[model samples]
Target: MKKNLFLTAIIIIVSIGTTKANSFKNNIYQEIKKDSARLSELDKFWTELSRTVREGDFEGYQAAYHPDAVLVIKQNRSISITEALDNWKQGFIDTKLGKKNDKVEFRLSKRIGSKTTAFETGIFYFTSTDSHGNPTEDYIHFEMLLVKRNEKWYALMENQKSEATKEEWKALE
Candidate 1:
């Protein structure tokens, strides 16, 4: 009788342990699924941003940012996105008028965030035509802070770090 009681206790302990392990695994799986969904949404956001810049959609490009967004440059100066937009408006107008062409491409090195926010580090390649009609290209290192509001993503801050080499840009995924 004592032997049977001991055996039953061991089995119960083992069963409880197994159940706890399975519960933990399920939680981890759910978190992974949620993260994947968030990433997909972020990818869509970036794709739309690229399209706006390529098409010179000034309103659409501005819409990607929050009304109170901030722009930081090389740890030197900071300005409101509205101010930056004001400075950049002529470029958009020129592009829209076909007087100039512009294109931007981003390659991310790191992204960290939850469902509602993300901080991204990457390099951006910008190509444009100067007033003299000369083509110019630049690779800039940048960090972006984004937040999701009302199921839409918006840039909260854009930190343009410094210049990057083409090889450096190519190194990041």
Candidate 2:
């Protein structure tokens, strides 16, 4: 009788342990699914922004950014909507003077964290026209820190315009 009771107790403990482990696994799976969904959504936004810039659709770019958007351009930084717009306009003028058009080719290098907050790094290739109407290209590595607020994701901070090589970008992967 004692042997049977001991065996039953061990079986009960093992069953409970298995149940808990399964529950934990299920929870982890759910979290992974949620993160994947969020990453897809973020990717969509990133693609749209890139398209807007490449097409020189300033309105579309403005719409994607928050009113209080902050942009860091080389050694200059803008911390307000008006300032950001002004900075863009200046850059646009310079690009036009060079007879160069802007194109952004971005490859998402990394995504870290969950839906509410994430760090994303990528490469941006800028193709434009020179003053002599010759084609020119530039490459920059960009990192954007994003935050979800009011059910929307906005870039809280960005580090961009750092010249990068293919090897450096590959290292990020």
The models' CA-based lDDT, in order, is 0.92, 0.74
Residue-by-residue lDDT tens digits, candidate 1, 1-93: 999999999999999999999999999999999889988888888888888777788999999999999999988999999999999888888
The number of the candidate with the highest TM-score is 1
- Candidate 1 stretches with Cα past 4 Å from truth are 130-133
Worst 10 residues of 2 by lDDT: 90-99
Candidate that scores best on lDDT: 1
**Which residue pairs does candidate 2 place in steric collision?**
98-130, 98-131, 99-129, 100-128, 100-129, 101-129
Rate residue 74 of model 1 by lDDT.
86
Global Cα RMSD, each model: 1.6, 3.4
Model 1: how far residue 160 lies from native, Å: 0.3
Q: Using Cα atoms with residue i matched to residue i, what is each candidate's TM-score against the true structure?
A: 0.92, 0.80
RMSD of 2: 3.4
lDDT of 1: 0.92
